[model samples]
Structure formats: structure tokens, C-alpha cells
Target: MTDSGQFNSELMAFLDASPTPFHAVQSMQQRLQQAGFVRLDESQPWQLQPAGRYFTTRNGSSLIAFVRGTAALPEGGLRLIGAHTDSPCLMIKPHADLYAHGYHQLSVEVYGGALLNPWFDRDLSIAGRIVVSADGQLRSRLIDFKRPMAVIPSLAIHLDREANSDRTINPQNDIKPILLQGGDSSLQAIIAEQFMAADEQLVDYELSLYDCAGATLSGADSQFISSARLDNLLSCFVGLQSLLASDASHTAVLVCNDHEEVGSVSAVGADGPFLQAVLGRICGDQLDSALATSLLLSCDNAHALHPNFPAVHDAAHLPQLNGGPVIKTNVKQRYASNALGAALVKQLAGRCGVPLQSFVARNDMGCGSTIGPISAAKLGVNTLDIGIPQLAMHSARELTGASDPLRLVTLLTAFINSVAPLCVIAD
Candidate 1:
């Protein structure tokens, strides 16, 4: 119900607050709690009622929220939206502190297909979940350095004459980020300083380096948005906004999973049982019937046509920033959208008076995938892959059209709140 400008302002604030997946879900929980949503525990018996809005979390990274719609079960089934919270970044390795030539650095491994060179000469900080010894077992808490704590400086061009054109980065040798220059430096000691702990030891951690400059509107007319983790966090926030504003007739659900950037195979990933378990409990004996009519809107960011490299995308299917949301497709099933699902999306866009676009990677180029295929295969539900087009997908910072996010949220709100069932759509 909010205007686009107001929605975008809040979206940027959400991006700034969620530096890591753990922080992302926490922000989501806080927003949903403020919207009159109650928290549900996986270990407890769920007594969902009509008109109730509730949510649950796992591994402090993934989240699932649902609203019992005004309609009865089997009449409309579940309207689902899915996205991932994690993005490509460098994660600190165990015993990461390393000192050489009076400089202190931390050992890190690339989390996904990240652009290695852009990571250099940029401000970086650490954030993620930490486990400390509590009473007897371990307890977890999220932390953010929230300051420029590290950088991966490029080798001087003077040292290598062809450094500009002939650059080769070794992950093992060159990608280690410099934290500080000093002696007797310890990564654990730095992390311990952030903990409000007494008689507690840092046992386990999953921290990743992030850009601290945060999000802002860019471009000549300030029509572009630049930020870290926009690959899917943009979708997560858009889906959240849509769900909050939706007035659907059927049950509605929103899931923001972790580990999509890393193949979505972990306990909290889409490849696992998280969605299935929740759906099983929600529908109980009606699981089969509910799934037959359910639809999953797998939301993620699409690759926009880069002016410098337009051939990277299919000529006819090129998507543009600010155009609107895209219905992504792949002949390889890498993206799960089909004719039936596409029709449903187009119809909803028409009903909402929003423009729509499509994206297909160049035939010779390998296409990236989303959680769409995984969830469809797991639950036997029809799935549609859609997203707002953006540039610099795996870079520390990415860009998108300033208006596209709110536009997508408007379309999604229609999809989730639609009165008609999407079960047997005509092509």
C-alpha cells in the first residue's frame, strides 16, 4: 500500500542492516514481528488459524513466513515466494590470522563465483554468526564489525609492467585480505572484543567480509541503486514487502533460504527438507492435494544487458534495468519456469498494469540457476523463476534500477493476493 519512493527508502535501510545472512533473517523477523506476525517453533505443535500470520527460522540464516488466507484449504492452496539471503563474498577460514613482512592478514576462501579483482582496493568488514560456550552447550549470537576492517590491495603496477592487462589472481596466494599491519595480532582476540561474554570462548564462527560503504542511489538521474548482496537480498526484501501488503484469498508463504550462492545444499538450503517439512506440517494429510495446486515464485535478480557486452544475453530476450521484472527461462531446466507458469505471471502483470520482460542467456553461454528448480523437484509444485534485472551480480557491490524493486513488489503482491487459483492456467 505504500508508494514506490517510500518503499525504496525502506528497502535501502533493510539492505544496510543485513550485512550477512544471519543478520538478514534477523531483520526479516523483526519486520514481520512488527507487522503482527507471531513466531512459530519447529519443535512445537503448530495450531495455525485463519487470518494468522506467523514465521519460523533455521540456522539463524533461513526464514519462512506464512499467512492463513481468508479462503479454505484446497480452495486456493498456498501462494509461495522464495529467495536466498546469502551472497558471494570471502569467508574467513579457521585459524585465519597470518603475519608476514610486518603485515597482518586473514586467510579466506571465496564463497561463490565472486569477481576477485573488484574485491581489491575496496573497503571490507566482517559479519556472521558466532557460537560461544554457554552454560554447558554452545550458544550463538550474530555480530557485525560495521567498520572498514580489511582490504585486498592490488600488487603495484611498478612491480609488474603488464599488471593492467595481464593480471592473474591466485586464490591461495593473492586473495588473502589484509586486516591490519602489526605484530602479535590475533583474529580471535578481535572477535572476542565484540562479544559481551563472561567465561565464554568463541567455539565456532561463519563470518564473511562485506562492503561497509552501504547502499545508495546512483546514475546520472539517480535512477540506479548500488549495494552489496543485491543478487538475491533485493528479491528477499521485495518479497517481504509484497507479503506484508498482500490480501490473498488462499494461504500465503514467503521463504528466504540461505546457501543459494553455494548450491543450496545445506540444512537451511532449498535442496534440503526445510520447505517440505514446513509444508508437510501446514497441510498435514492434504499435502498431496495442496502441492498439486501450489505455485512457487522463485525470485532472484536477473543479469541485465551490459552496454559493453550485449552479446552475453539472447538478442531478443534482452532485459533492461527499469523495464520491469523478468520471467527468466532456460531450456535446460536450470530455471524452472514453463509456459503455464509464464502465463500466470503475464496475466497477473496485466491485471496489475505492470510491464513484463523475459531473459534467456546466449545459447553458447552457460546459464545460472536459482532455487526454482530445486523446490519444484522437491515438492512437485509448479514454479516460476522471476527477478528484477541488475548488473554486477557477484561483485562486492551490484546495481539495479531504482524503481524496479518496488515494481516487482507490486506485481508480487498481486500474485500472492490474487483471488483466482493458478492451478490449470491456459497457455
Candidate 2:
């Protein structure tokens, strides 16, 4: 039996090891590989076997792992947990190298709705995919500037007397991260040097700035996790662990898509055909029927009730840190937790002996949406929005209860492993 402390320890390591989506997928792939799961490629034929464990990756950022079951196809459907590998960060542009006042800075674009204030003066690094030509063939390589290579400094208070009073960030002008002091070195040169590929040429890249400060267990009693990318990476890791532990009666799938933070519309995102294509191959002619009966657990991070701003949350639907997993809801379908889905989760929680929590935004406040509704509408699968409660969701470093992840793992393992159907016919 794995204790909560051990789980948190692993989660912290996962967070520290994964600085970008590319790195995140690599980390998950390594874990699944160690757990006796084989890797499959999309270009090659998949000879799936019953009771077999296999996984696959796309664009090196998105990943899907599944376990074949003993039950019949289509009718048995699938138990899937979907999460995103993306978080709010600054992405380096193509012409990123800029020289200003003898200090070289990297021009970046805001990738998502990042809480920009927290990004200033933080220890930052760069990591993403780089394209290089080798032997007249195009190849992709993942790079990580793991050390404190950059920092987005704030304007001095003396320069702006009202800096603290009305601070508004201009992404174009105010957020250029100073990387080094030089005019001769290009961005490609820096990357090529890191690659140790003096013979290779750097053509293009998709790099993002990241917090190099590692994840830590905070609080006096070490009861909290403080880290970056926790919004979705936490769920990604939890789903991976649960799927690896499950001997699911029906087919179990875990899809961690990229670009969810930026609306999930890319070739490797959840909105694209990556998942549908995989389902088609797995279900054969029964793809439609299998999807109709399939259940999707859209696992993302849920907002926890802030101690300082309790009024921001719905009074009756406040979720607390360390309470347990939260089933997020919205009447506007921002989250796809319908009556059936909510009941199913509650039932699973009961069986797993995990306390269930619910989260609903204040009526006047605009609610944040997840990948749940998009998945349900696109695939026609029954989807439920669920996650661990955490504070400072889109910040550079977020906070969460240490034990919440273990609770989610327990529920999801039982949920996926259960042999019974997700719904009753009401005979």
C-alpha cells in the first residue's frame, strides 16, 4: 500500500523534472515504460492484444496510453481520463534574439492567460522542441536550458513612482527576459551550442520560458505542494499512475494533450483528431457505438477556495485544500458534469472511501472552462470534470494539499478498474 507521503514525494519529483510539455510527455513515457508498458507508433500498424499494456505519443508533446481488456469491444466501451500537458507561459518567437543597451533579451509572446505579475523577477529557463537538419533529413530534438538562464525583471520603483499603485504589464515592451549580455550570439547559436551539434543547423523551434525553481513541499508540517504547471501536470501524472495500476475490465485510456491552455486547437491538441483517430483504430467498425458508451474523465485542476478571497467562490460550493477531489460543475456546460456523471463519481468515491468535493463559481463571476465539454461535444462521450483543489491556478507557482493527489489516484483506479457499466438501464 502506497502512503500519501510517498505519493507526494513522487509528485514533487514529477513536477520538478517536467518543465515544459515536451519534457512532461517524456517523463510520463519513461514512467509507463518502467511499468511494463510498450510503446506504439502511429505510422506503424498496431497489433493490439487483449490484456496488453501499450502507449503512444504524437509530436513528442501529446501522449495516449491504454490497456486492452478481456471484455468484448464496442459494448465494453472505454474508461478514459483526459488531461493537458500545457500551462500558461511565455513562448519565444522566431526572431527571438533582441539586443538592447548591451544586454540581449528574448522576445516572447503570451501563450495563455498567465498571471503576469507573478512572472516578474522569477528565475526562468527555456525548453521545447528544436528542428535540426541531419544528413539531409529533418529531425526534431527536445532542449532544456535547465539552469537560471533568464529573468523578467520589473521596473524599478524609483523609475515609476506609482509602480505599485497601477501596475499594468505590456507583454511586448515590459516582459522581455534578459538572457545574456552579447550582440554576436544568435538564438540559434545558443541552442546549437547546447545541442553540441556544431555540424547541425538550427532551422526553427517552439520554445517556452519556464520557472527553473523546482517543486517543493511547503507549509509548517509539509502538508502542501508548491510548484509550477501544477494546474494540469498534476492531473496528467495522477492519470498516468492510475492507468498503470489499473487492471481495467474494459479498455482504459489516458490522453494527455497539448495546447489546452491556448484553446486546444493545434494538430497535437485535444480539439484535433488525435484521440478520435486512436479510438477509431481501437474500436474498428464500432467506433461510434464505443464512443457513445464511453466515459471521459476530464481531469484538470479545480480552483480551491482562497483563504484571502473566500468571496470569489460560491458560498455553498467552496472547495478546501486537503479535503479531497472536486467534481467541478457549471450550468452553462463549461464543465460536462451532468447528473449522471456526478452520481457516478459520488458512487465511485464512496466505494473508494475518498471524500468527494464540489466546485461551482460565484454567479456573478465568469467561470473558467475545461476540456470536458469540448470532449463530450466532439466525441459524444459522457464526460465528467473532476480534479484536485489547488490555489493560484494560472500562476507561476501554484499550491495544493499534499494528500489530494493520493485521494484522486485511489478513486480513479477503482473507477477505471470497476467491471460494471457506467450507467444503469433502469430495468
Candidate 3:
């Protein structure tokens, strides 16, 4: 077992380094390479062997890492864990430069279902992938300013007496971050300067603004973690750690897809063919038989019961922070957890001695969804939705119990190494 403090310390480092999905995938790739996992290119032919560990990526944003076990594919099947790499934030637009009233700003569009209010009055930085033309060829590069470069200052109360009561943000005009009071540099020039490539021509880019603050332990007793993108990054880190600690006796796969926050419709998203294509190549002729015995655990942060908003949660199904991992369920299939899937997780948690909790939205309120339903539908695999409890899910900064992350990792590692049958026959 890993120390909770050590695990959290590393997780904080990961969060700080990964300001965007491209960065997150890059960070995970480094760790996977260090662990002796060979990288596979999708465009090339794969010569996979049993008991080999390998990883692959799509669009430099999503990643899939797997360990082929010594066991047969049709018998043990794949123990797959899924999470999303993308989060809600402000994305930089194509023509981002905006100069108004002697102030240079960058126009940004809201990405995903972000809580716009929290974005105001925050020190932000930009980081993402940029395509540049150099030496008569196009190349992609990842860049992070790694410092406070801009801010979205809120208007004072004097400007509007109802600023706090009836304030509404106009994504188009209100959220443009001020870059400098008076600057002659364009967005392209700034990016080129960062790369020290004055001769390179900027072709296209995908950039996003992120909070300058790093992840840290908070609360009176330091029981909570506060950071940006915890909605799904927390799950991504947990899944990665669990895969690293597995015994490798059974086939285990960890897939962190991009664009789940925006309905996952992209080519590299869970709704696409990324995972399916990889699985088909791995299972070959035994794909159908393997899927029949396979199980997927879709890990995403669950809404914790907020003290101030206790009435918003279902009375009996309220999940608490620091309690344990949550098994999310929705009768409408918003979540993919069924009785059989939930029972398997319960069994695994019980064997690992990890506490478990349940979460279901109040009858009147609508529930949020995760990659569970999407992956389950796409792969025809039994899937369960589970995660650590968190608060202020879509805010610029989110919170989760510091202890729950380690507990969730412990339970998932057990699932990955388990020799028990993954399937249960229904009467």
C-alpha cells in the first residue's frame, strides 16, 4: 500500500504540471515510458504479445495504456478503467488578439459547462498545443507560460449597484482577459517568443486559459485538496496510479479520453472509436468473447453533499467528503451503473476494506453524466460509474477529500489484480 501523503504530494505535482489536456497526456506518457511501457503508433502495424505492457495516444490529448496479462483474453477479459482528460475552462479563440481602450486583451470562448462566475477576478495563464511551420514542415508543440499572464477583473460595485445580486456574464464581451495595459506584441509573437522560434510561422493552435494557482491541501486539518480541473483530472490521476500498481496477472487498461465536458462527440473522445479500435486490435478474433466477460469502471468526481446546499441532494443518498468512493446511479441511464456492476464494485471494495458510498440526485433535480454510459454503449461492456466525492464540480477551482483519492486507488488496484470472475449470470 502507498502512503496517502506521498500519493497526494505526487498528485499535486501532476495537477500543477498539467494545465491542459495535451499537457496531462504528455505527463502521463512520461510516467508510462519510465515504467517500461512501450509506445505504439496507431498508423503503424502493432505486434502485441501476451504479458507485454504498451500505451498509445490520440490527438496528443487522449491516452490509452494497457498491460496484456498472462491469462487468456476470453477468460479473464479486460479490466478497463476510463476517465476524461478535459475540463471546463476558457479556450482561446482563433483571432484572439483584441485591443480596446489602450488595453490589449485576448478573446476567449467558454469551453464545456464552466461556472463563469468563479472565472472572474482570477489570475490566469494560457497553455495548449500549437501547430507551427518551421523548415517548410508543420510541427506541433506544447507550451505553458507557467506564470500569471492575464486576469479577468470584475467590475466594481460602484459601476453597478446590483453587481452582486443580479450580475450576469456575457461570455462574448465580459470574459475577455486583459493581457496588458499597453503592449505592441501580438498573441502569435508572445507564443513564438516562448518557443524562442522567431523564424517559425504560426499555423494553427488550440489553447486554453487556466488558473495560476497550484494544487494544495486545504481546510482546517488539511483534509481537502483544492485545485482546478479536479472534476475529472482527479479520476485520471487515480486511474493512472492504480494501473501502475497492478500485479499484471490480469489484463488491465486505462483510457483517459478528451472532450467529455462537451458531450464527448470528438474523434478522440469516449463517444468515438478510439477505445474500440484499440480493443479490436488487442482481442482480434476473441473480441466478442472478451467483451462478454469484460468490465469497465468509469471514474469521475461525484457531487459531495454541500453543507450550505444540503437540500439539493437526495436525502438518503447524500455522499460525504472523506467518506469513500461513490457509486453513482441514475435510473434513466445517465450513469451506466447497474445492479450487477454496482455489486462487483461493492465486492471489490469490501475485499480491499475500503469504505463505499452511493450517490443519486434528488428526484426533482437532474443528474450529470459521465463517460460510463458512452463507453458502455460503445463497447458493449458492463460498466459502473464511480468516483471520489467532490464539491464545486464545474467551478474554476474544485475541492475533494484528500484521503478519498488514495482509498479509491486502493479499491481500483484490487479490481485490476483480482482473479475472481468479472461476470455474474442473471436469473
Q: Which candidate is the best by lDDT?
A: 3
lDDT of 1 by residue, 1-427 (tens): 5577777788899999999999999999999999999999999999988788889999889999988887866778789999999999999998799998889999999998898888999899988888898678888899998899999998888897998888888999998888888779688888897774767888989999998888998988989999998988999999998889867467889999999989999899999999999988778898888878878999999988999998677899989999999999998999999988898889999998889899988889898999999999999999999999999989999999998888898899998888878777456
TM-score of each: 0.97, 0.97, 0.99
**Which candidate should be chosen as best, given TM-score against the real structure?**
3
Q: Is candidate 1 or candidate 3 better by TM-score?
A: 3
* Alpha-carbon shift of residue 169 in model 1 (angstroms): 1.2
Q: Which residue pairs in model 2 clash with each other?
A: none
Residue 328 lDDT in candidate 1: 94
Candidate 2 or 3, higher TM-score? 3
Q: Score candidate 3 by lDDT.
A: 0.93
RMSD of 3: 0.9
Ranking by TM-score: 3, 1, 2
Question: Over the stretch 1-427, how does candidate 3's per-residue lDDT look in tens digits?
Answer: 5799999999999999999999999999999999889999999999988778899999999999999888998899899999999999999999999999999999999999999999988899999999999899999999999999999998888988998789888899899999989877799888888874777999999999999999999999999999999988889999999998877788899999999999999899999999999998888999999999989999999999999989999899989999999999999999999999899889999988899999998889998999999999998999999999999999999999999999999999999999998988777
Per-candidate local distance difference test: 0.90, 0.89, 0.93
